[model samples]
Target chain A: MDFKELDPILHSQLRLAVVSLLISVREAEFTFLKEKTNSTAGNLSVQINKLKDAGYIEVTKQFSKNYPQTICKITKKGIESFEDYVKALQSYMNPGGN
Target chain B: MQPVYCFINRLFKPKFQSMQSENFSPKDSLLLIDSMINQAKNRFTENGFLYLLWGWLIFISAVSHFILLKTRLLKHPEMIWMSCWVAIIFQIIYLVRKNKKEKVKTYSDGIIDNIWMCFGICMMVLIIIVSRNNLWIYMYPFTLMIYGIPTFLSGVTMQFTPLKIGGISCWALAILSTITLPIYYLLLLAAAVLIAWIIPGYLLRKKFKNQH
Candidate 1:
């Protein structure tokens, strides 16, 4: 039986959680993601930057009421990669491919 | 035995690295995805402010128009509807504040916003057409029918059964309006707003509070 290899980028807990949340909403603020994932600002910033670097998500920075705001949106590649990752995970559970 | 152990470790080392520091299993990955998705889905809560606002506004307008017309106390009972312009201003302010406060945008929020905008445009066009042709007698029935469209679509979008039922009730009231006297049209309009907006508005508020 052969098991499909999962995408390395999405295998990490924090990165996977961020991607999962982004996929569900049209766009989410940095604070909203931090609250939902329970991740520290430093860690989430690093993970989201990794996702942005991979072209899996888009990050926009702007000022609202004189305060900096960060918004994140999932890219088309992100959705496709997430779907593929799920399929790979499924293959591990059902190695016979039935 | 020592050489065999070293070989196996080397073989699996790359796979383990790929798994990253958290090293969660495939099942755990699936569970995390499921839970995160659910959290996102459940995050939005409708305060039902607009629904209640418009619902009560229309209800009051219709009832006041009926009473004034019946008593002949005012020469222009129709002028009572001008209050809606004030409401329109208030609604704009409320929406702007809400947009500033909102941290996330859901797909359903976008869709629902468009739905209500369409409803607003339709109502404006309908009122203009009725007034231009002096078709005021047919107004309530048409208005009730228009009320049902957005309510029904919103219900389907939000998966709220009370709103669906409220929408159906509006259509039923619309049909009944045609067979009744003109004086009773105001009553029908009031009933339509009560069922389609007011009832669902309160229920939505309750659901939102509970979720929060």
Candidate 2:
């Protein structure tokens, strides 16, 4: 897949932030992502839904300690896309994939 | 006993709630929370470093055993076992270091992982220095299986396919090693442990370090 084509999705800072955090953690609760991104619940939820629609992440809703919890996990496709996005970004920055 | 109260009441909530929202923005709250998390992460990193040190202590001891195997000291198997105990002492120190770093203590998989590795180390050492009969041969496969279980679990917990694959490979090799116990099985056992545990241990240590 040509990652340059994914520039629009990858260019959004909030979406990029979501992917980066997910990469490290493998999975995170919605509250955790909300706090980390420092974005409003509405905005964060919207972006997460977008990523989910894109097949980049899977959202699982569950209960923890009687509290509703939403968990997000990046898929293999997401990982591949993120790597490609990183390469594209690097090329844009350095004019070389290196 | 109530550490939460100490943090909320004694530390910040009084001054925080007293101040006007105009004076203190949510950005300030974010900064405070970030600092708190950073400190927590630093503590975790230190604990991970201590764990890595424990693994390294065992690695060094194993290497020492290799060297000692060739020398006249080979005659003194009890002395070598004593040295392994010394390594165990260092491992205890590592455990202490890890325990001190984490406050909200519960037995997580990391504790289980270390405990399993410790068992494997002890059994492997006994097989080398004490057990002379054919029954000792089982220790080779047993240690391999013990070492692989935690590795596999950690991989599943973290959702990493490569690590999961590595763990399965160790299990498969352990079985194969058990079956293929021909001449020089001791050397083969060493090679298997190194591949199964040591290499993955190093990779895990490195991965844990980077995650921090």
Candidate 3:
């Protein structure tokens, strides 16, 4: 049994989905992430904060069309962790390395 | 309820029905990442607009130039190139409008934008070279070759095959044009634009619509 431990921050369902979407685009509006992840605004906001606190993502607050806009972008560290997290999952999925 | 809030809720409501129904498994995480990445990579809507615009402009200009020369209908047939200047202005407007409408800037979008900007600069320099050195006879083939550089790279970035194929055809035609008489090179360029820009542009548009 040579299973690898997953990153605790990315192990949850909603958090994992948010990071998954962010990994692809590197940056996305908060609404885009919310829509893609299918998470409630409150829940998505909380997960985004967790990712930011972990230094895995950066959150930008700006104004667009006189409305407050929140944009979330993945940092270098986020990419590294996402890659490692995927690798860990891969090993777990195929422990025999086949 | 506010209209904006209602709109947001309507947009998000459908997604809620299908989510969080399963446990947070590592396999699910892997699947999510794969799907999300594919979604990001397949954007083609804006590409179509750019390709079709430039393609038609160049194609019409080149074909008409060839015709005017062949018929000897105009004393200043070279003036047809002014259309390209008009197209360039429209292209600027298109870019600025796109910039205003674009909300999220992807890494790939930024790279593609820079590639086209560099291509524009090269064309200006080529124009100067031709006007100053009187190398108009040799210019079309060289210009076609230059066009291929960005076209090929755009294909790679968009992961679109038609653009790559289009780019190759431009270079091949350029080589052929170099050996042939310069008079026939305008026709070759018209052919080049049809392949390198118009076809790929429409294909890009189709892909974009399908994705949306």
| Candidate closest to the true structure, highest lDDT | 1
TM-score of chain A of each: 0.97, 0.88, 0.94
Model 2 fnat value:
0.00
DockQ winner between candidates 1 and 3: 1
- The DockQ assigned to candidate 2 is 0.02
Candidate 1: C-alpha lDDT: 0.87
State the weakest 10-residue window (summed lDDT) of model 2 chain B: B18-27
Model 3: per-residue Cα lDDT at residue B157: 87
In model 2, which runs have C-alpha deviations exceeding 4 angstroms?
A1-98, B1-73, B76-81, B103-134, B160-163
lDDT of 3 at B140: 92
Clashing pairs in 1: none
B1-212: candidate 3 lDDT, tens digit per residue? 24433443344345444454323455667787777776665544355897898899889889998999999999999898898888888889878767645555677788888999999999999989998999889789988999998999998987889999999999999889858888999999999999999999988888878867
For candidate 2, write residues B86-175 as lDDT tens digits.
766877876665544322222234555565577566766767663666565565566566656765665565454544665686677677
Cα lDDT, all candidates: 0.87, 0.56, 0.80
Please give the lDDT score at residue B186 for candidate 1. 95
Q: Ranking by TM-score, best first?
A: 1, 3, 2
Pick the winner on lDDT between candidates 2 and 3.
3
